[model samples]
Target: MQSWQKVQCGVLLSISIAVMAGCSASSPYRDRAEDYRHAEPSHYELPPIPGQRDQMPIPQGSTQGYTGDEFIAPRPESMQTGVAERPPVELRKDNQGPWLWVNTGPAKVWPALQRFAEEKNLDVVYTNPRSGELMVRADVGGTPAQRFSLRQGVGRQTSEVRIVSMSSGQALPFSEFDRERMMALEQYLLVTQQQQNGRVSLAAQNLDDGDQVRWVDRDGRRLLVLDFAFDRSWGELQNLLSNGFDEDAQRLDDQDRSQGIFYIHYLARAERDSGFWSWLFGSDNADKAKAYRLVLTPSGDMTELHVEDASGQPADIQVEQELLDWIRRQLT
Candidate 1:
């Protein structure tokens, strides 16, 4: 029995040595916890320092904080009370029959033409806004294949649209077809103009008169001032004079844009004696249409429009004022 006890004690001692060896192999950082507990403290506590809670002083009349009723956001630099408005488009024809005019710029009209072409399913062959030209292939049902060319008007803010038919692969003047297309374009422009009339203002207003037209006194002569370029103003003036006056009573007989002169005829309102008896009586004293010249002179940014007699002399003050007033009334 004593021999058995000694053998058992040796086995127990070997087992204890094996277990300690296994634990030391698995836990290499076992001494780190003891080392940390025995280490000196690195950080020191700081004492509280007194300071003023309110360092910045508020202005005498200012509040310390925002009030509930105060407006927190800044005011806008500009206020938009309403959308600007533009005039309705007016379609007109010049003395030259082949060209038609629409009272809008090429920029606006070009897009509208594109939209029209798209709606009609016409294939656009070429389009150049810079050159103010468009060519399209019209192949609508029940109509022969055609090619159309649209050109912008001479003025910056106008369009002189034209169309041509394709015959034997060549372009030919399509007067009737051109008129039809022009009418259709006119309808589109009219609708768009009306729609945009409430949203955009195209004309620059004169601060002095609150109108697009103004008057200036230059070199002892009163001149009518138009807030448009020479080409546009000239076209608009021509349109106004042609349509605004009584039928056949007032007309522009001749014009030389290069020379800036328009020869106009204005007949008196009194009825002229006519027929065989009146012809036999010799109605030489009857009032006849007087010829006048409208001279456009560009001075810097604005164009000066002055009226003169056919002999190239300045019109009388009364005649000038009367014509100027009439034009102003018509334009405004």
Candidate 2:
């Protein structure tokens, strides 16, 4: 009976302790909160420090100065807010490569670039990261002043522009791409120049026929090359080469010493018609600038005949066979 009474007493004591703890937590005051009733804010709210059991001292008057902010605890860093800048690379990356990267400002890069220009035969007039003047070497000799510029892209991109002045008073800007294109364009210029030179060289051979004409590609045997100009008559050319030339030369010599022209006749069919030979071989001053030639070749005999001019002069030329052989030797 005694133990049961003690156990009942113990149980009641535990209940009493719990109820007292709950009451204390629920109460808005610890002791004598009524004494500070004068200090109570008319529009009271809890401070950041929590329950506000502690009142911060304030001036006796001026309720407006005592904002709720006055009693708050210091703010945590995460709570602070404002615009923030992007972090520096040094701060962002834990470890950088061994060598430090410094900007080596545009001023420093200029000298090295200047040295580079000099070696390239370009004069370093003045350079900045932007625009400047430079002297560039010319093909003939010496150097001439030129314009230069540097351009940058949105990112850290860079480019160079060079302007060259030719003897003609115009400036041409050369980009990186222009230099590459010139390699192919220059080849075209070379080929055209060579063709013009070849046509000039072939000019001498145009007036004669093969066998009697100059054979540039000939071997030991005599050869002639003939060209028919689009404007001239091919029949006249044929007759002149066949027998008209020798006949005209002889006729002119026999006619008279006083008359400049002499005529000759080849009695090809025996019609006594020298007029046919004369008509084809004789020159009319209207076509004086025009004439056709033929080259006739036999190893032992080569005789080519050029026609007479409108002045009645004899058609006379002595083209040798050995000249053909000599030209052929050169080709090989």
Candidate 3:
């Protein structure tokens, strides 16, 4: 009976072990994956791609395979350029003066400003103390200073703007200040022909079937005087046209605005004539009709000026490259 019992126990133990091994073989690899699910990176930063407008793309070409296990890169400093890599831009003529005044301050602090100005071939003016008021005076000393003025106690603060003259008989051709100012300034162009309290009519509105004015430069180059051209009242300086010119030397076919026009009336002065320019002006110009004769000084410059002659009007004028080149030559 004891022997029979031992045989039964041994067979039962062997059968239990066989049953467990069969169950393990029946299960799949997925069961093992669920058991190991605790691993994770959570989040990480990625490198930029090359060939992008803002960044470099990776792998040289995404279509190709990677080398070894991963790729290597060179030091960033070795591939990068400096902050000053970009170049400076040119400014428009009207804004040039103000812009330069601003940049000049920083220029005094920075070595690069001086170097850059020299490289671009521009003139730089520096003053002691660099006070704003003194700078304004210096700016106007060489050019027509009164044309522009400083305004304070308005809106945001103080700044510069052009002032208008209100002397013309409620009429004006051109003024930095809009229409209202132009009307006021028409007199300031100040036609010596007619003067009441120093206000003068500069030109007459006479429209003969065929009559015109010419744009002559200091050098005597003739430019086509468009319909807009008219004999404005000669300013304090008769040689100076004062205002009422559309564009500068480049006005051939383009519609634009120029700084201002200065009518020298050089020939009118040289030829000793005045009536010619006045008649083309008009009868409304009845009060403002005076002739100016511009004579070259011994230094080869104008001493006295006159307009109109016993013969025809001032030589046909035109705004040409030679004209501007010549005028700037004489003025500066």
Say which candidate scores most in TM-score: 1
Q: What's model 1's lDDT at 230? A: 79
Tens-place lDDT digits, model 2, residues 239-259: 222332333222212322122
Ranking by lDDT: 1, 2, 3
Predict model 1's lDDT versus the native.
Answer: 0.61
Error of 2 at 20 (Å): 38
Stretches of candidate 2 above 4 Å error?
1-38, 44-112, 118-121, 125-130, 137-146, 154-157, 163-165, 172-332
RMSD values, in order shown: 22.0, 42.5, 27.5
- lDDT values for all models: 0.61, 0.32, 0.27
19-71, model 3: which lDDT tens digit per residue?
A: 98887788674455665477675687888877557355464543222335544
Model 3 CA deviation exceeding 4 Å by range: 1-93, 96-269, 272-314, 317-325
**Across residues 58-162, which tens digit of lDDT does each residue of candidate 1 receive?**
857733223456443422312321112324454454433444455555556566666777886777787655555556654655344454444444334445565
Q: Candidate 2 at residue 180, lDDT?
A: 38
Global lDDT of model 2? 0.32
